[model samples]
Target: MKNVLHYKGYSAKPEYSAEDQVFYGKILGIDDLVDFYTENAKELEQEFHAAVDDYLAFCQEVGKQPQKEFSGTFNVRISPELHRKAFRKAQEDGIALNKVVENALTEYLSPAWHENRTVILPEEMAKMYSAEEQTVDTAPDDASHLALWKRNWTVVNGRTEMKKRC
Candidate 1:
């Protein structure tokens, strides 16, 4: 389920307040603080849309520019080891660290990546075919396929890890 509402190029993150028995949200990526509240769940989205419209109207009345939703720049925190690894990879690829991060994010968010990819967990593979049952015919000898499988799946400490891409 989506927690954010979108309207007319503006987005708001609405959250439920159990104490107040209402839903409240604020305009996202705006210079000024704009908030809205509603007690009815059905009206929550309407309230968000109204708040966004009002914010835009107020901006126009004041001759101010409304902030865009995304600026394509943000800060992220990572462990030093990961940071070093990413930096090293970027250097090896003759690209900037930002490009590396952007490419990773794009691949992760791309629907084609999810649709074209097939992941077989170690446990699932074990259930489907035992090690003893694996024959030369069952496993291809192509190096390219082996490389692709290596790139797609990794087993660390006997636990298979699957990357989220959707």
Candidate 2:
């Protein structure tokens, strides 16, 4: 004889007949499945109920909901040594190796590497001082003069008393 069980709109048929049991129970490792069912049936059932409760509570809290569905895939590649190290770390932290990788990449690619600059010059300087424009021999070599001028301007601006003396 066979029995069918239904949960969450899905049905599972388990054969317990002598001939079918020989195939499912002996050959296909269904005996272990039965042992697991017998040993942890109540706990597993409780876990399912708790999951359903949590899902219902979440739906209520959010107000609007869609039929639950599985979505998305993530993929990555790494050196074998790095993969092994990440796997070990994930095991220690009780999280998926993918999560560790995601966190690492997120942090590495963050805007922390960016910096604000005080001054940016227009591109005309390069065209204006082409090699043909060498009349002064040392009219303060290359755009270094611009930086020097900025520094001198700051010094002159800071000396208000010296400006009055002048």
Candidate 3:
């Protein structure tokens, strides 16, 4: 079985070696190599944390900055045609190509990015709701409909009206 341990925001994946009769794990993402081993899960957990602490301490002693998992920028290889199309779409939308790429990547990686995370409002903001409540028309269930899309025209106050193109 594959075992994973998390400590101090770092994740370690453990693999068992039948010949060695021990479970060994290494921290996954950062460039630094950290390894721990144990026969038991509880001991493995302690070792995992200890390995992380040791890594941090070693970096501190050496005066080397800890490596972060991601730098928020990376090179992506795509066909030249697709690259040109993306740039053209960004130009037509009047937005930076970087923003278009970022948004598309975020949406693809996180399916629930557009969904609300919390079901109920926070208790600290209850006073705002206690005031005279004003209701606004909610968007469509499947939000891909044009009602949510701002076009040359929009439905305002239950009537279709022409709007200034933005």
Candidate 4:
């Protein structure tokens, strides 16, 4: 079963509060924090729509714009070590660091694409597969697909490891 309810392109992650006997969620990936809860499935749906409407109404009343959950651009600060690594990767891939990070985040968040049955294909895999291989029955699984990413190896502490950073 689907866990989230979507409204106006915003999605709320579903969780159960056992102690409170209710289903609750936080609208994710937005600047503003919005919390919603309800005791039953029927009420939960209504509450979800109400929460979104109220948030928009509140923003209108306050003369502020409501934020979309994702805007395709955001800042993230990483360590100096990662900074050096990502720069090197960008150079090797012949792409910008921003594109590298964007691709990585897209791959990492593939599961979150379920709402529209969408997918984020890795660069190598997208090229590796034939059009026929794109079928659901022929598609690769998580474990095997992950192995493809591990092909290029490096020695870290005298052991072989894959570079997972973007």
TM-score of each: 0.66, 0.25, 0.51, 0.53
Clashes of each: 0, 0, 0, 0
Mark the regions of model 2 whose C-alpha exceeds 4 Å error after superposition: 1-72, 114-166
Q: Mark the regions of model 4 whose C-alpha exceeds 4 Å error after superposition.
A: 68-86, 106-166
Arrange candidates by TM-score, highest first: which order?
A: 1, 4, 3, 2
RMSD each, Å: 10.3, 26.3, 13.8, 10.9
Global lDDT scores for all candidate models: 0.73, 0.41, 0.70, 0.68
Question: Relative to the unseen true structure, what is the C-alpha lDDT of residue 140 in candidate 3, on a scale of 0 to 100?
Answer: 40
Compute the lDDT of residue 24 as modeled in candidate 4. 88
Top candidate (lDDT):
1
lDDT winner between candidates 2 and 3? 3
Give the higher-TM-score candidate: 1 or 3.
1
Local error of candidate 3 at residue 110 (angstroms) = 5.7
Superior by TM-score: candidate 1 or candidate 4? 1
Off by over 4 Å in 1: 68-73, 112-116, 119-166
Model 4, 1-166: lDDT tens per residue?
A: 5577888877887788899999988777567888889888678877878888888899999998788555668788878998999999899989999999888889768874323222455556455454532222222245454443223333332333333312
Model 4 TM-score is 0.53
